[model samples]
Target: MTRTSLRGVIAAIVTPATPGLDPDAPRFLRHARQLLAEGADGLNVLGTTGEATSFSLDQRRGLMEAAAAGLPRDRLMVGTGAAATRDAVELTRHAGDCGFAGALVLPPFYYKGVGTEGILRYFDAIAEGSAASGIPLYLYNFPALSGVPYTEDLVSALVARFGGRIAGLKDSSGDIGYARRIAALPGGLDVFPSSEAVLDQARAGGPFAGCISATVNVSARHAAAALHGGDDAALQRATAIRALFDGKPLVPWLKQAVAARMGDPGYGPVLPPFVPPDPAAVATLVTELEKIDKAPARP
Candidate 1:
């Protein structure tokens, strides 16, 4: 099988929503263009940063379609994972049909205590169902949200079983040790760290293909430079920017920054169960982020 490379910065883009709580397709298209122009090599839409779980099936499909219409297929990877096997398969198939480069598959996450066999079976079923079209699959190993970690053994088995169909793994574990272990695997699977803090190490040949950071939605150019430069100063600046969202709700804080940059007041409102930050919190965060933004990028 020919080896597939996933080297470069891939932004986990936020799906912009209008004041009416509908996804703002035009805004998303503009964001995609901006990210590409700012030096992002690829876009990962519908991931956690995109509030994927909150979206209805129709909404998710619409987002994917809009992205496909706006960006080149090779530059887009849509998150298609769902708690249900059929839903994941259907979404993955849809991504392929819409011409996305690949589908980022989260393990079946709803059922806690699910055995490794169960998780493997879920992916196997989706892969088998998607076999005819040969849609590329990237494993999204975010144990924090999914509560199901993708162990090395499991990844190895899946890669061996899926062969060229399994494209890579996106490790959001936030544990550099685990990321290093995944990178050390023999097949040269594309390993993406979820945080920009590891870019220096990753750039120094640590097996990290690139980053798919939530913060990159707003700071794509800075994140891209950090990945390419691989210097401590660059990583520190990126980390400091991410630090702004540390104590607050990540999504809301991110939305606030994005809104401030784009001058869209509607961007601050999150969907149900994720209320916007209190006014005081938003004020403080805005001030802090403004300072960070104005600071020079490290040499």
Candidate 2:
């Protein structure tokens, strides 16, 4: 059955790359299965961490097509946002047609300082043009990368117009207050903070649906614990693990961490813009992460 609540730890897993640096479908399914086994309630595939934009539309769609072979479509939320409107719609439509749970979409990021009307028009165009006409569309908000913030007013306007299809907003702004404010907004919007830093607070009082976190790929246990009001210490440790990469590049570190965890060498290649760090750097990071991995599980 399709999961409708949207409350749970949804991991923005990294795209497992092949030796040729292509998106590997079998490897992705294996990663998804591992995350699920570790306690991820759902998988947010093709996300920022997954480097969705790095792959061609056909590659992304091919992965989507192959996902249901091993991953459950009802539990998959594919990142279908693109810098171009048509590209976004095409990917979003693919997610819908694949029978996945939701499509995480970002506003077109081509021209900085584009008006809110243009942003709304972009969303409107996708809603009107795609097979996502009936699917859940989770707006992806990452001002740091997209340079286009999904302001509260724009969110309300989009929801007001397309409430049926507007699933909710996934805020990667790393601003807890912004996430809480959106969570507290009226209507059926489900707010998901991108990081686990705000997880405890959001879980305790905010109207948060859950967290859509990149770290959850490795630290799902703590995130799941926080959601259930379990050990804060465990959650804090998980938060600290993420902080280890502070000031360092996040995506590459995460990819390296994955490689270390899986004992595979091929998981090192990131797309062009974000090249993989040297092996010595990766070895240093893996060594650092080993301490946490070897630590005792808190009750």
* Top model number, TM-score: 1
Off by over 4 Å in 1: 1-5, 230-232, 297-299
lDDT of 2 by residue, 1-299 (tens): 13364567889988888767689877677778888887778888889999988899988999888885678777788898888899988888877788887889988987899887898889887887764347788989999999989998888888887776888789988887887777666666778888776666656565777889888877877777766756677778678777777787777888888877777756667887887777798788778777875677764
Model 2 TM-score is 0.93
The number of residue pairs in model 2 that clash at the backbone is 0
Q: Which candidate leads the pack in lDDT?
A: 1
lDDT of each: 0.81, 0.80
Instruction: For candidate 2, list the clashing residue pairs, or say none.
Output: none
For each candidate in turn, the TM-score is 0.94, 0.93
Whole-model alpha-carbon lDDT for candidate 1: 0.81
Number of clashes in model 1?
A: 0
Identify the runs in model 2 with alpha carbons over 4 angstroms from their true place: 1-5, 131-133, 202-205
